[model samples]
Target: MIKGTVKIDAKICKGCELCIISCPQDGLGLAAQFNDKGYRYVELIEDNCTGCVNCALVCPEAAITVFRQPKPAKKSVEKK
Candidate 1:
């Protein structure tokens, strides 16, 4: 399976839950601490992200960035 992750710009996030709601994997959540803007920022709470870009698409501040790593290709055995 393809692995995924996200980076959130805490400084710019306005604590909107739109990204959290749009996340199919339920990987996002609000941080315990507040950002520079005094808003609780969204963060990756789980490792089940699939990099679907759903969170990024729904983010009004464009603070979320998703990265996807492709599954490794399998090696085939040679027939003698």
Candidate 2:
């Protein structure tokens, strides 16, 4: 059950790394690159996210958001 989840507002983000440390599950990280404002952005790693939304709550910039992945659709079988 692997998925990508992390919503960030680049314009509002100041790259403080507060979200990085706040994550109890270690989901958030500082990306290798910077945004248009030259601020290092945050990203989510699959093995890391527990969807606690700790990062979202601690973010002073209101830049981070977490979402749960949608469940897979079930298949229908035909009967004779």
Candidate 3:
């Protein structure tokens, strides 16, 4: 399972809700408070993000940034 997260630039976000709708994991939501631009910004509502980049792709303002955790390394067995 790939664990991931996202960061949103609240100052520039216009509360378009495009990212929220594009998110497949339901990890994003609009903030209750407004930003300096007087628009509610997007936020991570769940910890189930997979860094799919869907939200970022749909964001017109390009305010969302997705970060994915690296996969674990596989252990190798040495031949005796």
Per-residue lDDT of candidate 1, residues 1-80 (tens digit): 56889999999999989999999888899999999889999999999998999999989999888898754442222222
- Candidate with top lDDT is 1
Error of 1 at 15 (Å): 0.8
lDDT of 3: 0.87
TM-score of 2: 0.68
lDDT score, candidate 1: 0.88
lDDT for each residue of candidate 2 in 1-80, tens digit (9 for 90 to 100): 43436788876788898888887777667778888888887776536575667788989988877776544431222221
Name the Cα RMSD for model 2: 4.8
Task: Write out the backbone clash pairs for model 3.
Answer: none
For model 3, the stretches where C-alpha displacement exceeds 4 angstroms are 72-80
User: Which model, 2 or 3, shows the larger lDDT?
Assistant: 3
